[model samples]
Target: MDRAPTIKDVAERAGVHAATASRALNPATRAMVNARTAGRVHEAARALGYAPNSAARSLRTRTSSVAGVIIPDLRNPVFPPIVRGIEDALREAGYMALLGNTDGDPERERELVAAMRGRQTDGFILATSRRDDTVPGSPVPTVLVNRRIDGGGVPSVTADNAAGVHLLVRHLAGLGHTRIGHVAGPRSASTGWERYRAYLDAITSLGLDQAAKAVEFAEAFTEAAGHAATLDLFAANPGLTAVLAGNDLIALGCYSALAELGRTVPDEVSVTGFNDMPFVDRQRPPLTTVRIPHYEIGREAARLLLERIGSPEAPTKSVVLPVELMARASTGPAKPQDS
Candidate 1:
């Protein structure tokens, strides 16, 4: 069996000191050595096919160059794009990402955080932030993504859910939807409560006092919860012509509820969703939704986490990305009978 190439082999080939060869191989230390010596070391390493041990490199620098990402659930289609963005950005920056899914359980989240911490991850990018979290002692450079920890000073990157909800309400009102219904997400999440408040404020500002009663809350951010909430709203106010769902998955549930009631989308009842998840445009009635920059948000969160890891004393930041409305077949002018 052939032995693996070593730094000594590269040093001999380049006629340079072994320490110089090692320093040249490291990106951080490469600049300290003369450019000509570094070039010779690189050439010799390539010629000898010398590969540095990652474990040794980590031990030398006390940095793993890896970030831990904790998400609520991976089953949601919306998460895949976000994960891809994070991975791509990290790869480009010569870092790696470790992903952990908690399935939306607080205990599971705590376990995952502990496991990542044990692994000595440089920092964390968290997408699950409960109103009350028991996970004590976060990573030094942790950054909350898409959710904010209550009373915690961690930096965060989140969509402007309030502004997005305001856009949805205005769109519905413009389409003559005087009575708009809302299927609010779980209040335990920041996005949920923020969106609910935005809905109420928009309705009052639009003078849709008669429509305010149609808003209803969902127990969770799931299709089943959406379906149940939509049904309850329909029962309470049969005159509602439009509904703004908490998220795309919840919007899917609204579709099911409307189908069960023999109602047609946009023809009888218009609907709008948040977080324009993939394949939403290909639904039976292409869903109209607010396009939150999920992938961009993830990439930005990863970048922020990296910055925080580099400088823990940096002032914490709360980044709120903008959103846009994508008009589709699911929403249209309110039915004449709605009024």
Candidate 2:
């Protein structure tokens, strides 16, 4: 009664063997035990204030029960929900998340990965990976969230960027916007590249091939970058009636750039954005954008990473979740060229 409650104590209280109690207490092995018996074991452990010694289990299993989650930036407003989903999924499996922010720096990302590996993290869920990047010497499994490599070497969970972009472009074109411009995100990231490529493809398919010339690439997926790129895009093609921003942040920059040029949104220039992140709906004119399931992206990434961790030899897989178009006040019938 004086000493810490042991597995034996828990087992006796639950009328089960010590091994059964052990399996019941562990999330990984809980499925092997009977549901009723596992519940009783859990109840017994809780009643007796029993806590499993994770250190001992780690020593035996060679797994830290922790995952390294690396993201580009937390300020973007889209990543927080994804992170929350990852944490929720991991916690359900008796695992913890070790989070890091890379701020879109490759060197910083590598350093964080190394530090997390040094701490014996079981695997990694990266939201900062570039298209050409690789974890060459990584001994543990890694899954990509919201970003992916050029080829299919690692598992990933991403939204359907191409589909989302095509949807936005079609929506704009349907609004009588033939002269549409694009402010693309950095080309290095898959999200940026896919959306940009999709824009060209969509325009070409719609017989608006000349519209592709009115495009400018942002340095990063940030408001300032979007602002600069939008200005460049407009300077070259001032006749464009609609602007399809690479993402929500970029669309926000369009607002500032258009304002600076004295172009009233949806009157002179209708605008669309992607990743319907956070408060875009509350902007002076609510932004019309593609809605990706941010939280589900994180949860799916966690699921893929856990699958890889459990079965390291399993065939690598990727999940591309669907998206929806959220139409709002920011877009409307394009003004006539003379107007």
Candidate 3:
């Protein structure tokens, strides 16, 4: 069997001391070696095909350079971009990401958290944090993304849902949408409550007490829930002329309900959604929504987690990313009453 290439082999080929070769290969020590000498050592390593054993290096450093990322659902379009951001950021930092999907179940989340902890992951980027969750007890550093925990001061990166909802409501009000309805997300999640409260605040601030009555809550962050909520809202208040959906999926549900009721978007009842997920623009009637930087939030969360892992004494932070309103085909001025 052929012996694996070694630093000595690289040094012999480059006509340099083995110690010099080792230093040249080490990222920390490379600057100490002359640039020309380092280049030569690199050439020799290439010729000898020397590859550092990451497993051995990790063992020696007592860190796996692996971060665990937990998501509530993989099927949610909002998560894919966020995961990409996390993976890209972690890869750039020479760390690996281990992804786990909890299907929005607390038990599954706890199980995944335990498995990740058992694997000796250096840290975690959790996108499934519930207000009552206990997963924050992990000894390793953790950063929440797109979610918040109650009383856990862990660092987090999340979209400003309240601000985004406020923007949406203000936009609707400016368009003369006095009879606006809201299809809120599940009450169990932070985004849900934050958005719901923001809706109330925005409506109240606009001095539209009647408009606030149009708000309804969905059972989950799914299209079915959105559809059911929209149906109930329409049944409860047949005069509503505009609807604010919790997310894009919920907005799609609104679309479904509108179709079943033979109502056209924008022309009959304008609808808006939050979280501008991919392909929303290409829908039959493009969704007007709040655009949260989902991917950037994930990337920033991973970056913060890595920083926390490196400097455990660093102060915890809560990063609130901004959101923008995307005016599209789904939202327009309210239809004329007589039309």
Where does candidate 1 have its weakest 10-residue lDDT segment? 131-140
Error of 1 at 61 (Å): 2.7
lDDT of each: 0.84, 0.90, 0.85
Q: What is the alpha-carbon RMSD of candidate 3 to the true structure?
A: 4.9
Best by lDDT: 2
Once model 3 is optimally superposed onto the true structure by TM-score, how far is the C-alpha of residue 227 displaced, in angstroms?
A: 0.7
In model 2, the Cα lDDT at residue 167 comes to 93
For model 3, residues 1-339, the per-residue Cα lDDT tens digits are: 199898899999999999898767654345568989988998888888787665775686667778999898899999999999999988755578999999888888888878988887888898888777764636788999998877767898989998998888888888778888899998777888788889999989988788787878998899999999999999898888889998999999999998888888988888999999999999989999999998899889988987787667779899999999999988788755612
Which stretches of candidate 1 lie above 4 Å from their native place? Answer: 1-53, 134-139
lDDT of 3: 0.85
Among these predicted structures, which one has the highest TM-score?
2
Residue 93 shift from truth in candidate 1, angstroms: 2.6
Candidate achieving higher lDDT, 2 or 3: 2
Worst 10 residues of 3 by lDDT: 23-32
Superposed model 3: Cα runs more than 4 Å off: 1-52, 135-137
Model 1, 136-213: lDDT tens per residue?
445457888888867768888999998899899899989888988899999999878888889989999999987777
Model 2 lDDT vs. the true structure? 0.90
Q: Please provide TM-scores, in order, for all candidate models, with all chains considered together.
A: 0.84, 0.91, 0.84
